[model samples]
Target chain A: MKATHIQLAHGNGGRLMRELLETLVFPALGCREAFTDASPLASDKRIPLMASDSFTVQPLEFPGGNIGSLAVHGTLNDLAVSGAEPAALTLNLIIEEGFALDTLRRLLESAGAAARAAGVPIIGGDTKVVPRGQGSGLVIASTGLGWRDAGCALDIRSVQPGDAVLVSGPLGDHGASVLMAREAFGLSSGLQSDASCVLELAHAVRDLPGLRFMRDPTRGGLASVLHEILQASGCGCELNEAVIPLRPEVSGVCQLLGFNPLQLACEGRIVAIVAVESANEVLARWQALPEGQSATRIGHLTVDRRVILRTPLGGQRYLDELAEDPLPRIC
Target chain B: MKATHIQLAHGNGGRLMRELLETLVFPALGCREAFTDASPLASDKRIPLMASDSFTVQPLEFPGGNIGSLAVHGTLNDLAVSGAEPAALTLNLIIEEGFALDTLRRLLESAGAAARAAGVPIIGGDTKVVPRGQGSGLVIASTGLGWRDAGCALDIRSVQPGDAVLVSGPLGDHGASVLMAREAFGLSSGLQSDASCVLELAHAVRDLPGLRFMRDPTRGGLASVLHEILQASGCGCELNEAVIPLRPEVSGVCQLLGFNPLQLACEGRIVAIVAVESANEVLARWQALPEGQSATRIGHLTVDRRVILRTPLGGQRYLDELAEDPLPRIC
Candidate 1:
């Protein structure tokens, strides 16, 4: 008989755990052979880049994606934005006892597919089961190993006073999509989370000689990324609010819930800094990708160390660092 | 006012999260500079090894070590046993909302100390917070990156019928200590978890000409490791029960609780297989280390496909794969 749900024994590192991994995990994740404690990685000549992230989104299954695919993309994007080509990924799963085995299978398969799509292999991983009630269904922590391009030099210190600020696409779609999935406010929208790998968008701009740095606007959205730039580069940003791309559905949710669209998350977007001379080229390359159809230059770095937004009505307002929790587990 | 417990806003990746990381995490973990999402690793000429594990032990703190230290040792040991020198580590923390801030600080500091002791730097990491009542206070996942020794060629397939099996130290101290810490059975003992880095022990014998393989007996302990060898090498094991290292305190706990000492966990022990000609040198080298004072040859590989234990009374019994979990979250 097959176990319908996870058991404590399944994490005991005994027969049951072996059975669970061999029958479900290995097959779902496309593991070709039984893994030892640690696996050896192929040698790479280029400098190595490593990034790790833990995914704890509520309602494990959200619109457009689940925690599985989100985990892969989140970690991969960190490397992607750092001007590195992802080499491999390691997954760590913390499962709650009594969680449905079928659900676990689906998530693993989804993660496998996402990795395959991105051309990275899931080389090694570990799993543990906590007693029921001590955990929320599951949490996945993924670490990505990548190889940086030999000639690429990207850093926040390179940002200058007149550098342009650009975004790969519309912001806040992911935050809005997850909010509607919760159904806490009885709101509905056709919005889907823009949770995806930003590898292509990053690769497109990585070779640009004038590129300063690129960051994925995730948890705290565009506002957070802007604040980070102010702190790291000693350069503030002046945004043209009218030109910043945003979806109508995402803006509607923010208006109704008293949330700032700029403070909402967008998993599939990139905030990049580049010299004014090369800004148009960066925009052109990004716009060529389907994921970046809405790419736009929304702002520019300023001499003053304060993030200021110019409203369409010619009103100027300072954008402070995000100070409150708009949504928990938005990632 | 200082917050005494974690809040959802601390994970929002905004002001609160930045403060939490800067004021607590960075200083405690010896991070000299603010970290970007992904950190570049120095290139290593040798083959790289990767391993990952999640620690979900109950009680958070045990008799001899806390989850933080355990997390470091567990992942590093995996790499060490694979004949790799630890290079770097990545930490992932999943904190429950309302978890005590002081506790978090202590764990991070302990983890930092452990990493420092092992001479491994934490290059990158991530943190996420879950809603209250949805997590068991804290769970830590660690991933280790290592460089394999150039001449080391360790694999289970290297074992043959004449290979001798040796254990570095007594078994079950970790399991017994954690079990007693729970106080579920109102039992007490002086047992302390033997949790520490096994790098020196592994290094001492990793280059032995006849060394077949090495494994750290963790979750399913000695019995499970032997079973794995049997399955992978297509060779069984013949163990002499009288010579196996068993601490009196651990044996007492197992006897009173109807547990099998051979099947309980040990955090800092190694089980090695070597050609009979090299077994004495391996045991001698290991016994010189404080962590391996009780090192002894316990068994030898057999032609038959069965794990047979020779009893002190001249009777023999088959050691079957562990089916039931004696204790959950023992690691």
Candidate 2:
């Protein structure tokens, strides 16, 4: 992590990435909210959340979704998790010269559909072209804006020792699918990305007084988010490994690759921390929704600042911050 | 323009770029404000503007600004031209693996300075790295949010015949400086980019009843803006080419390179349309500002849908849509 040059791990949304943001980006830019999922805009009444991310998946097209839909879903989820009502998005595209028109058309169509489904519009955008070989075929960057009533934001400060953590659905499906699609390991499990907007899940629990914090396990996956909450709140968690939801196909791919599924990405899932008394209610509401059908309580926050996983074998292990990005550009 | 593949022209912010947005992106995305500089966020009271743009300039650094400052200026100008007071920004970085850390730091510093000067903060960002050679060292895509009192937004539909067109300052400085710095044609110039934020100018005349529209002449330069106002308003223009301000060095390079300075980019300039009665007030107010000291009345909107250039030789000629991209990735 001491490397001077940018390593793939620096963009992995893991430890190195956190180091880069805290050391270089945040300090240099003086951005207080540089590490948060979304930052609240300056407002008197309802403060809107604004956040952005750049998507650069290797193959562009994958089993469950393409880069377009992934871009839309990624930005929307960031806003949703920050307790905002998704409103609008801006699409910025850096296309390689001589790229196929039909491919661009297809991607935009998917992006349009995702926006429409989420009830957001592509408001304004920019397009730039780099010479061939100087750019990936396509790179999409999106910024999402969402508004919510004041005091409804999910801040790490809100998490207390007794808060319970829950997962909306399966983990690692997105990372696994895109990795399998790349055939990097000479194997294909025919998995699909679980990329979708979870505004519905956010809405179900948005008004709940017990909701403390929420986040989407994206690039660095569930482990990264857990570490973020622990570090930010100065608290610990005892995660029940057996209760963590995992799709069999996704777990199979990770096991074969000797990768931890908990450290893999999931595009369409929510990691929620709520009062222990209301955990079951939140789970029930999420489970009633199609995207969150498998919602379950995975763990609970503690007084210390270490993440411990309670294995089904009656043993315990510390879940450290993800070191290297096993799957680069997995969106 | 009819080609099935995206050529460098499509990203030039000229005719081809317009065609792509109109025929493909806009239609597919169903965005009514797809062509505007910024879109108003949905709200019952004050409406804020949201916009995004990607910056991928060659050499990364130039005389007046680097890609980082350019990223900030470009997005802020877009929001300003749309008549909003810039509030926050999201920075998304796509870096090439192994890119120099010092270089990244310097760029971030510049970006930070620009954001601070413009009174906007870099709230959140996502960084991803592509393997070396797949990217141009670094690419920064930024999204900006600006708020305006309800009903203060500028729309192209407000343009009308007899409206005077004004240039904030010299044209083609940015495009010329970057083009010369590339040394692609074995030529170099001491000229610097006019890259800057014109929020002050935007605020000065934003409340003027005569103000119709404003735009930063970036990618396709002065000619492009003229054409855009004409096309969007379904009107014509009589541009006095002899009166348009031009820096001697920029014009020299453009002439030597067999390019039209009129089509060259100007990152810090504004092309505005205002009522003839108030054009003098707008010009005088702008000229009093440092960035707009060279401001001058350049032309007027007409009743027809054709743009005519009043040549210095006293002959009139058609000013067509930017037919080619003289310098790609200039901004």
Q: Which candidate is the best by DockQ?
A: 1
**True-contact fraction for model 1?**
0.84
Clashing pairs in 2: none
| lDDT score at residue A295, model 2, on the 0-100 scale | 94
Q: Residue-wise lDDT of candidate 2 within B1-331, one digit each (tens)?
A: 2445333333322234345445643333233333211112334345667778889898899999999889988989888888887777777878776666556667777887888888786666666767667777889999888776766746777888999999899998988888888877777667888988988988888898888888888766777677766656787899898998998997788777787788788888889999899999999999899988999999999998888989999999987655435466787
Give all TM-scores, in the order shown.
0.98, 0.86
Candidate 2 lDDT over A1-331, as tens digits, reads 2444433233322234345445643433233333211112334456667778889887899989999899989999888887888777777778776666557667777887888888786666666768778888889999888777766646777899979999999998988888888876778666778988888998899888899988888866787788777756888999999989998998888778888888788889999999999999999999899998999999999998888999999899998666545566787
lDDT of candidate 1 over A21-79, digit per residue (tens): 89998888877777678877777688877788999988888888989999999999999
Could you tell me which residue pairs clash in candidate 1? none
Candidate 2: residue A32 Cα off by (Å)? 36
Instruction: Give the best candidate by TM-score.
Output: 1
Model 2 residue B141 CA deviation (Å) reads 1.1
True-vs-predicted CA distance for residue A297, candidate 1, Å: 0.4
User: Which runs of model 2 end up more than 4 angstroms from their true locations?
Assistant: A1-45, A184-186, B1-45
Lowest lDDT 10-residue stretch of candidate 1 chain A:
A30-39
